[model samples]
Target: MSDKRSFIYMALVLSLITIATRATNNMVTTTLAPLGKYVFGFDNLLAGIIDAVVFLSTFISTSYINPTLQSSSRKKAFISANLIIFVLLGIFYLSNAVIIWIITGIAGIAFGLILPNLISSASLVDDKRTAERLLSLYSTSLSISLIIGPSLESYVLSMFGYKSVFLAFLPLGALAFGLSWYVKFPEVKRETHGMSAIKNKGFISSVLSITTYNVPFAALTAFLTIYAIEKFGVPKDLAYFSYIPFFTISFLTRLSMTIRPFNSLRYPLLISILITLIGLTGMVLSPSFYSFLIFMAILGIR
Candidate 1:
């Protein structure tokens, strides 16, 4: 293949791997809280703690371990990480409450390996504009997975028990494992001025914005279905459907941005913060499940 053709093929492979990895991860995350509460008889605090273990491990791995592995072959790391997750998912099917927490933490470490490599691969191109577009497409793929993952999990939950939800995503783990070999791993570059970039105001603001967004989102992912069932008497299967509109709007927003990115972040960032506040407030005051879904869509805009 020509160099350009090779790049395109690798980009496509990376996107496929991303979709499968993200979808399976989403299934696990969305399943954990309800599974803990209903299946294992965990209290709300325990379930929340179990749900949080994944993020905690991921943070440690990314912040401390990933940089040290920069000289290693990313292709090997990525494949190994996916394989670890695949095995962990199999173990999760048979896991009790205590084992589930341990598995979630290990799986998070695997994700910490996988996710940063994917982002680095997407940014391999030399041209700045092309790199941005590729990153945008990568974001779109993530949104697509977020939409599909919960929707399919909802269907599976309707037919089977919580354990089966983990089984349902096993195929996706295999798919990601298979695709991992085909991606072109980006070469590692040591950054001497990493701290300088961290000192930039743009970088600082972006970090703050992302932190603000993820805190609420993490809470929602952990508790939304439980809240719906307890508060509104939504059926267990249908309770997962509450995520549909939120993820759908998120997918649409990313798809649009990939096609035409904003020229300026100023107004869009401000508007998104405002929308998030209103959406969160509305959800608190919502009297019905349907109204809560509306606010979920609004929150997705952020």
Candidate 2:
């Protein structure tokens, strides 16, 4: 294949897998509390632990495992990670509370394996403009998953059951696994040694900046529905729709950025942070559902 053809094929595969992986993750996030209570007999404390452990394992696995894998092995690594997550989802069907936590931890590790490699792979294109556009499309896939995954899982849960939800999406996992096998990863000229990224000032600042943005977003994803229900007496089904506005606006924002690449990231980044802070404050202080939804939309613009 010509380089351009190869790049297009690879980008499409990556985009599909990105959608699948993100949707799977969001499905788990959306249904986690119910899955814990109904399937695993989990109390609040234990369910929280399961959530924490997945991210803890994710941190460990990404920080340690990704640096060890060669760029050449990223394709194999991605395929292996998807296969692990696929098997883990199957395992979730048979698990009790304790076993579910273990499965979550393993799945987190698999996810850690998936993300870094996926980003690195997406960035492997020959031209900077193509790379940015490909990344933007990949990010848009994340917003698509955010919108689709929870809605689909919620519908599936209402119609079928918890176990059926996982079973229904197992095909997505299978699809990602199959597609992963055909995607080619670029070669790295030099291997990055352990923890070398920490030494770079730019890398450190970027990590800290992103971590700041994601920390609250993570909390929101995990608890927004529950908070809406408990705080404002919103119906369970109604609460689930909260993601629609947040992600829809977010998707549009990213799409705009893709079309007109930011020449000065400084002003936008500053404005995003300011808006996010205001939105978070509004979320805490707001007394009603409408107010909260407005704040969420504000944050989504970032």
Candidate 3:
């Protein structure tokens, strides 16, 4: 294939996988709530903890995976991880065991393996700054999915039971596996550059800082739904919708950053962390709905 044809094919393929991955990201926390309450007979907090099982793995895996694979991502490992994730989704559906948590962990590792590689590959192939704009599309897809996924889950689960959601997911995973086989990413000419970057403490420090910033966003993904429902007693769908404003604000915020000048990422990173902290604090302490909304905006500055 011509290089342009290859890039176009790869972009479409990744976009499709993004949708499926977003679906899984959405299901990880919300679907587990009912499963925990109905099947496991657990209380609200415990159910939320169960949901965190996947996210914890994502954080831990990404932390380790990001650095080692920066200069050269292992495409075969990504292919294998996708295959494992698809099989695990099948096992989760058929078995209906809490071992689904381990499956979630596997999915998390798959995401860890793929996400950084996707970003790194894109940056390597094109303008690094422009790549952020492209990534915004991916993030927006994930954002819109927060709206679509649970709605689909509610309908499918009601029609065919909770297991049906997983059934629907299986084909999507299979599709991702098949499409991943077709993508042809660029080769890296990083032999000397990789050695130089390895010696640069500044580069390592920058990556570590980026990792720290992800901690709060990861925490929000893990806990936001439970915080809304338990702390606020709002309906799940409504609470979810209520929170769309957060991501909307977040989406806009991220978009705005690309055009704006950067003196340092330090200030923005600090601001994002503070916003998340404020939102979490609001979840615990908000005395009224209005107060919570303010906190929600603060939560979104990320």
**CA lDDT of each prediction against the hidden true structure:** 0.82, 0.76, 0.62
What TM-score would you give candidate 1 relative to the actual structure?
A: 0.92
Measured by lDDT, the strongest candidate is 1
lDDT of 2 by residue, 1-302 (tens): 98789777877887898888888876665556656755677776665666667777877778777667776676677789999988877887777766777788888888888877677767777789888868877888778877777677757655665767777779888987887776657676665545776676577658656965788776775567667777888766566667767877888888788778899777887888888889889988889999888888888898
Ranked candidates, highest TM-score first: 1, 2, 3
Model 1 clash count equals: 0
- Rank all candidate structures by their lDDT, best first, as comma-separated numbers: 1, 2, 3
TM-score of each: 0.92, 0.87, 0.72
Please write out the lDDT profile of model 3 over residues 72-103, one tens digit for every residue. 36677667767877787777676544676666
lDDT of 1 by residue, 1-302 (tens): 98678767866886788899889877777778998999999999988888898878877766656665654565677789899988888898899977888888998888887887777778877888778867877887888888888888889988998888888888899999998877666556753233454765578778868876888888888898898899889888888898889989988887787688899888888888898889889888999999999999989888
Q: List the residue pairs that clash in candidate 2.
A: none
Question: Pick by TM-score: which candidate is best?
Answer: 1
Superior by TM-score: candidate 1 or candidate 2: 1
Off by over 4 Å in 3: 1-7, 43-49, 59-73, 95-97, 124-164, 185-213, 288-294
Model 3 residue-pair collision total = 0
